[model samples]
Target: MSHASTAVQERPTPPGGPGAPESGLSSRSLPRLAPVGFAAVAIVLAVGLGLAAGWHSKVQWGMIAALFFLAISYAVTSVVENRRQAKDRLATSIVWVCFLIAVIPLVSLLWTTVSRGAERLDGYFLTHSMAGVLGSEASGGVYHALIGTLEQVGIATVISAPLGLLTAVYLVEYGKGSLAKAVTFFVDVMTGIPSIVAGLFILSIMLIFEIQPSGLMGALALTILMMPVVVRSTEEMLKLVPNELREASLALGIPKWRTILKVVLPTAIGGITTGVMLAIARIAGETAPIILLVFGSQLINANPFSGAQSSLPFYIYEQYKIGEAASYDRAWAAALVLIAFVMILNLVARGIARWKAPKTGR
Candidate 1:
């Protein structure tokens, strides 16, 4: 043979005959059924162990299954592929496990509420009040509590929204020196103040002035609790509004206050509205303030500024306290109503967000 042919013959074959590693690392991958198979095995093992050990808690069994799934997945992936791919799979598995863990409680709570509360939820339940119904009877409705919640939350929103928005604007646009820092610090501190503490603060003021318990007092306490949340959310939203928008407005000979009112506020309006709604929802379900300030009543009191009022949360608490079957049913129904109210508010907020979002195409 010629010299070129001899050289070609002398050259050794590539690791796997051609264009491949000898260890087959590049070609290796976990089988498509790996996750499902591992999960099934883990579940079976966990169930068997739980039964053998006489553990009745499904939570414990679930934890064991999750742990087993993670371990078996990592081991199999590491053996079939490599350490790097194994770690990736392990992280993904961990994320899924955590998601399930977080979602389980929420699902359970919703299911329990819906199942137990649907029995008493009807037209009469939504329209009438608990004015003359006994706790042991199932004739009362949540209309009074609903009215109280709406009025109190509305008043609190009206008070907090403007204050929170203006405060946020100041912090973002013009605040400086010690005053700004002090405001920010206090706002942070107020964010963590308990609902009962807010109620107590308002109650103290009421006591000094010899004021009576009423829905207005509850609204005041709610305002104190809600302002910080609004401030924080609005401040963050304002921060997210690009500096370019403000600069462009200023470049057009606009005054600072006018620019803020005309440009900045409109730009962040969706987020501000959503924040205000969330704050309203939060205060709507507070029982402590209602109990302390409004002094829950069975009769409907349309005037928030004068007499004792009934709120959904306080009504739920009062009914549950009775510890009778009928009372329990009312409590669950009221809870379901509160949840639905909050959900509606959230849905409205999202709708507002979509509606007010800046038009990009036009």
Candidate 2:
């Protein structure tokens, strides 16, 4: 053979699989189907072990399966690839397992709620007041509770949303030194305060003034619980707005307040709306404050400012406390309504956010 041919034969294209990875990258890795195959094996082994060991709980079965999957993934990857690859596979496995652990329970709870709640959820149960929903009879509905929740929540939103938005703006735009720090410290403290504390705070004022139980009282308690969340969430959203936008607006000789109103507020409107909705959701389910302030009336009190009223949370608690078969149905139905109300708020927030979001890529 010629000299050129000899050199070509000597080199022979350094042997390895096609398109092998370079340094600082993986050379060999697990196949895409490897996880699925490993999961199947793990399930089989776990089930066999569980049955043999006389385990009755499905939770134990799931735990054993997760353990087997992790072990199998690491061992197989280490043998097939390398220790580094095995470690990566192990971490990924751990994350998937943890995600399943969180999601499975949520799915189960939603399933239970939907199934149980549907039994008593209907137009009749919605439009009629529970004025006479007595024992062993399904004559009453959640109309009264719905009215109280709407009136109380609306009043609270009107009271708290603006205060939260302005406070967030001050903290981000002009707040400094001792005042800002003090405000932040108080907000943080309020964020951690229990719902009962807010109720008691309002209750003390009520007692001092001889004020009667009313939806207005519940709104006041909810306002305290809501403002801090609004402040924190709105502050984070405001901080996310690039300083360049503000600077550019201010360079045109616009006043700081005007620039904030025209530029900053619009930009962060979506997040602020979401934050407000979250705060509303938080207080919407609070039974303690309502119990203390509104006092849970069975009769529909449309005028929230004067008379006692009932809310979805309060209604659920009262029904569940009855412990009758019909009461249980009404309780589940009220729980479902509460969930749906929160979901609608979230949807509205998302819609508002999308519509008001700053346009880009013109």
Candidate 3:
């Protein structure tokens, strides 16, 4: 045979072909041991610390340290084996840390409130309306303040909701030119305006009209304070509605107003509701405006339009200022109640958001 022909017949096959060698990794892959190893070490360390210091002492710091180690291990493994994994692992760790940091204070507040406030949260506290229960008789509830809070805040919500929603729609959907820009700029400015300033504005308005300090004045002040937040939140939520949905509606010969009402609003309704609830929560606990505008009344005031009223915030302040141990306890209890109410509002917002979320699967 010729040399060339023999050479061709003797040539080796490609690496991955019929008689080729396998690549670096095997077909049956072993699970990466880094995470497992890290977890094992973390458990052992945590257990040893708990045994030495008692579980209660180790609960907070020990767990936090273990989580940090686990995150570091994941990061190291990712850098060694997978480039994309590194970024994702790092981001996940950061997000978790952020969540934990946010949750810690809230949990602490709630736990403390529940622990300390239980004494004053009884039926007597709810029924007597703060009439004559004095000097640590252990019988006064927050009925009057609760009523005042509900009525004044209810009025404020009614007054602010439509105005804020319309303002947001105009800004996001129809706003244009210098006027719109000016309105948006001012709204942003108003968002940072001091709560006391809002009170002063309402107070000045009342003074001009010869109206005395009253619950109505307080509601008006709160409405002013809350309106900007509502507008900002609602505008952001409305802006999140996809432009494609608007175009699709327009293509179907829907009027702009109808499209906003039926299509856009409904699509972004979850976020809008959540934002509104959050805005409400933000203002409900405000003491500055309410205290400045409304005189605190021990008796329950059903009418926000007429006389002085006492909301939880004002009640807390009033009780705190009395300088008695009993009054101080009452103030703490009121604080607990206010915090609970805000938490309930947040929970409700979350529920509404979940319920109103667009169905992804039929």
Candidate 4:
């Protein structure tokens, strides 16, 4: 019992408890009661309110009550656990709700359209033209419109794709002069111009040459509208191609044009195809230009250069304008068909792009 022993005795270790010096109570050990308490209270209140409101139906009010209870329960539990954590949970819940809100409308629209539109999308719809359709009865199918759409749009792609790709290549590879700048500015301006204006431009040009509005005129109008989109998308994709690839080709003594054809184009073909498909999708659905430039006809027109023709979009418009119930049904059906075709095209393009994308892994 010397001086050190006396000091230890004077300040002996306190008994282990809530106030213990060595066994201090954890902040967590405080009862997490508030969240559970609030949840229980909310449940009771919700039930009482539901009963008071006389919600008898199992399908309507029952579902509503259940969702309300679930939301409240989660909110209360999160709050009782931790305020900061609860805030995050609340934000996550809000985001999920927003997502569902957006997705539900699209789902509903698709469901409704498919349910109604399935009636008209049959074998007959694909094979027969609407040339014979007349009077009260919806007598024929949309084959003519489908054919015209493909032929006209096909010609448009033929016209626009090369021109667009070359222009983009020029912009990316060699055209950095004032003329290039001017071209870029004009493209930007063209992109913002209204679709109807493009149609009218083609129409005016045709009138100047004493040519009539026809599917070819429509194709030309669409080409003008689509080229800028193609140029913009292709330019972006080409820019993404590594400069290193270009330099390596140049180092091999490949001429610039050959390098572009053999090396650069191959590397970026996937993106280029995707961009082209996107441009096609953009123009394929355009109604104003085709309607203004290519007057609708019921009979199938094989040659775009000769006479007036129709497209799926204009077909839909024409069907709706007939003001008959059968016509309206056909319009919905045609819309569904158009959407399906576009979706198929996108899928095919994606598949081709993925299948042929340059393999980096050995």
RMSD of 4: 6.7
Query: Between candidates 1 and 4, which one is better according to lDDT?
Result: 1
lDDT of 4 at 87: 57
Query: Per-model C-alpha lDDT, please?
Result: 0.91, 0.92, 0.79, 0.81
Model 4 C-alpha lDDT per residue in residues 205-263, reported as the tens digit of each score: 88899898788899998898889988998899899999999999999999999999888
Predicted candidate 1 versus true structure: per-residue lDDT over 1-362, tens digit per residue: 69999999898866545555434554578788889999999999999999999999999999999999999999988887767788889999999899999999999999999999999999999998888888889798999998999999989998998999889989999899999999999999999999999999999999999999999999999999999999999999999999999999999999989988888888888898899888888888889989999998888889999999999999999999999999999899999999999999999998988898777796
**Whole-model lDDT, model 1:** 0.91
The 10-residue segment of model 4 with minimum total lDDT is 21-30
Model 3 lDDT on a 0 to 1 scale: 0.79
How would you order the candidates by lDDT, starting with the best? 2, 1, 4, 3
lDDT of 3 by residue, 238-294 (tens): 988999999999999999999999988888888888888887887888889888788
- Cα TM-score per model: 0.92, 0.92, 0.76, 0.79
Tens-place lDDT per residue, model 2, 1-362, is 69989898776444364444332244567779999999999999989999999998989999999999999999998877867788888999999999999999998888898999999999999998877658567678899999999999999999999999999999999999999999999999999999999999999999999999999999999999999999999999999999999999999999999999999999999999999999999989989999999998878899988989999999999998888999899989999999999999999999999999999969
TM-score, structure 4 vs. true: 0.79
